[model samples]
Target: MFHPQQEQGQPSCRQNTEETDTDSDESEYNKAPDAPLTPHNMQTMLRKATTDIKSHLASELDKRLSGIKEDIESLTSRTNHMEARIKELTTSSQAHSQDSTYLHAKIEAMEESLEDLNNRSQRNNIQIRGLPEAVTMEGLHNVLKGLFKSILPEASAQDLLLYRAHRALRPQGHNGPPAFLRN
Candidate 1:
């Protein structure tokens, strides 16, 4: 059953299919029956594609710009908060510094007053010896007042003020001297 078309030493099926495809392509290429494929039509399509691409890119750029603005705003607020905190810390330190200076001055004044008080208290105190220990211990305050009256005679025993009275320790390794009462 060899066909006549196959006997001609040609690519039988391929040649037939190529001829059919080429005939259909030639008919499809002349799609616009009334108008021709012109440069203006191509330019119009190119412009439309360019406009669509530009619009898409503009929207993407706007989205990125808004995100960047949000990030910048967040950073700005954080920076403002840090600055406020730093200012608060600086103010607190300044106040503390002033308080420290005032406290130091108060402490120095207190020290001076304490020293003056010690000197005045010492002035009112008396150390006496040669009195019999028994007689001194019986009523040391009365005995001292009487002795002061006998010695001074200008001030009364009632006028003397005795804030404190005590027996103080003697110097170390000096045991030969007679014991004395210190007030």
Candidate 2:
């Protein structure tokens, strides 16, 4: 039998009963007032909560891990640069050390050459001792000429050449005897 409300496009008593039954069934499964707390419902809720937490934790861990990976890469790059710099410095230091050694050897050779030259130049020089400090340059020249004539009487005046003659430098009252340098 068709009702008047059903003919006017409104819900009839049978449709209302079916709608209420569907709503009550849905509310039983998804927490509702007067719905009994069954183990199945609790398990379903716990599974959903765990799934959400797992997804959140996974996302957080991924973000943190990506950041850590970037930091590690940056540190690795810096370490590589530092290692390269250290290598460069070590190479430069080794080169400088070699140069320093070469220069030191060259300097020693030059010093020996200078000492040999000095010895050769001073070989012809002579030192005259026991000479009075008050002897003048003219007096020293005359005395040396007379002594050379006596020592080599056959030698001419040209062979007896006196380059320079000077008194030894010292205090007025020193313990040492007087001396003269003849060159």
Candidate 3:
């Protein structure tokens, strides 16, 4: 079959002619005008372009590094603040524990003192039993006066006897004779 370009009378070697034309055009354009090309000027322009690109890259890197450094410093400051707060809380907790221990000791001492007072009060309270049916207030007074003389010598025999009779008659659940009858 006859190709379209061949039928239209176009060159069969058109691709080769186009390549040659492009090469020749580029070579003509690269030829220096009146001034001869110098290695020094080419080197200077290359150095300037490289320096500008490097400077821009360096500035961008410096900005990123500065932002990172600020973030690191912020993190460090926050860590320091947290450590200080932890120390303060630890100290406060220790002080509170010490205070609680001291309060506990004081409460224990107070309880012991109250227990002693209660024991002494119980000792002072007398409970007399197995008395004869004919036991008189006078006889009871004589006996208590002799017994309590060492602790409460200032108290009268009659008062001691009356208090004892009242307590004996009202012993817990048993309500004994009236006040006048006991007397």
Candidate 4:
């Protein structure tokens, strides 16, 4: 065959070039002929690399799973704490409600007792209206004593005793005279 590497007037030495290329290629492999790449070696390297990759992936997965587990445990603990707090608050609120109810009932009872005591204190007391402003305390007392004596002749002086006689604290109006209270 006509070769491109040959000079136009020179003959092609194809056989000699082929022999040189073969010798150089053999010299390179002759140095380590026992360690030549083969299917068995490639299969062993592939298996080792696959096992290493699997081990790495498993380790990463374990780390992530442990971290997730820790996070779940932390969340569970917080949830439990919150539940306990809610229960405590509920109990406290119930107790406070009971206390408020008790206080309200006691206050109402005290108010009723106060009203009853006021009515009882004023039951026997007398209010004399239309009394003239000119009536003195001593004069009103004497008039009441005489009136009581006339009304109850069998009563003793001690029974007709007047505790106090006084006029109303309000200013006298033009429509009516001042009133007196005798107790």
Candidate 5:
């Protein structure tokens, strides 16, 4: 239904025949025969159009601001989650580094102990190899007793032999003697 404010002969209050004709003429003028728009001029026009469009969009799409805000909030939450994950990973990496350092120290200590054991075993083996195969256990004990008495008068013969036997069984490797001996 046309309101009284509408111009005579027009069907709707918002429609104006003169305005429509003017818009049509302007559109035709925009397409007039001339040099094609240059890139620099087109870019300037595009920038101006974008600025106007953004201004119009800001005014017309005000109702969508709340939705945009919600989207921003979700993105922020995801970013926060990623930061927390990175922190967790960093902490775990540090802990793993500490664990690795401790394990390395333990391995070094074990290696030193094994080296000492190997040296002692080698000395005992040299001593045993020097002895005569015909030497009886009793003769061996007496020999050790005399040796200990000469060097360490305070040590007993039994104690000296026992120490020598312990030295002979000293470890020979990092893990132990070998798979056969370990088993």
Candidate 6:
């Protein structure tokens, strides 16, 4: 059938051109469109595309690596700062512990001094129980110096420091007629 290629006096590459004359002008015209795109040209274009893609990928990888490196360095710096803070905290803790130990020792010493002071105040005190409660406080006081001196003949009136004395309660349920005395 008469088609557009037939009207142009050209053979279509889709037909069996090999069965016809291989030296026809239409056959040469059919191959003209692919003449400039040789294997060498295609290979050179593929090489350039490969080189460009590789260079672009390399640049992208470099950017990612730099970002990761910066992140690692920042993390390391933060870790170092945390470690220093921990060290400072450890030192502060030790200082607080030492302060606590010192305070504990000082408190113990103060307690001991307070106990000694209490003992010293009571050193001159005397309590005489089972004395006759029938006597008045003046009567008890009058005989107290002589009674204390009788116990220690080595003591004089100056050494016999007798303080005021008074009566105390008897046993709670006791019906005994005599109450207790203190001097």
Residue 149 alpha-carbon offset, candidate 6, angstroms: 13
**What residue pairs are clashing in model 6?**
none
**Number of clashing residue pairs, candidate 4:** 0
**Model 5 accuracy (lDDT, Cα):** 0.61
Regions of candidate 3 where Cα sits further than 4 Å from its true position: 1-53, 126-183
lDDT of each: 0.67, 0.73, 0.63, 0.73, 0.61, 0.68
Per-residue lDDT tens digits for candidate 1, residues 1-183, read 222346566555445444555435334444654555443334334555787899999999999999999999999999999999999999999999999999999999999999999999788567875555455354877777767776788885567766655554543333333443334
Those runs of model 6 whose alpha carbons end farther than 4 Å from true positions after fitting are 1-42, 127-183
What TM-score quantifies how close candidate 6 is to the native fold?
0.50
Error of 2 at 51 (Å): 1.5
What's the distance in Å from true for residue 26, model 3?
A: 18
Model 4, which residues run further than 4 Å from truth?
1-53, 131-160, 166-171, 176-183
By the lDDT metric, which is better: model 3 or model 5?
A: 3
What's the alpha carbon RMSD for model 1? 13.2
Residue-by-residue lDDT tens digits, candidate 3, 3-117:
2344455444344334445435334435544444343224334545787899999999999999999999999999999999999999999999999999999999999999999
Give the alpha carbon lDDT tens digit for every residue of 129-183 in model 5.
2333344555666655665576687876555664443124433434433222232
Q: How far off is model 4, as Cα RMSD?
A: 13.0
Question: What alpha-carbon RMSD in Å does predicted model 5 have with respect to the real structure?
Answer: 16.1
Give the Å error, residue 13, model 3: 34
Give the worst 10-residue stretch by lDDT in candidate 5.
174-183
**Number of clashing pairs per prediction, in order:** 0, 0, 0, 0, 0, 0
- Please give each candidate's TM-score: 0.47, 0.68, 0.44, 0.51, 0.37, 0.50
Q: Where's the lowest-lDDT run of ten residues in candidate 1?
A: 172-181
Measured by TM-score, how close is model 2 to the native structure? Answer: 0.68
lDDT tens readout by residue for model 6, 1-183? 222334366545335434444345334445574656533334444555787899999999999999999999999999999999999999999999999999999999999999999999888778766566565777977666766776788997777766666666665333433332233
Which pairs, if any, clash in model 3?
A: none
- After TM-score superposition, the amount by which residue 38's alpha carbon in candidate 3 deviates from its true location, in angstroms, is 16
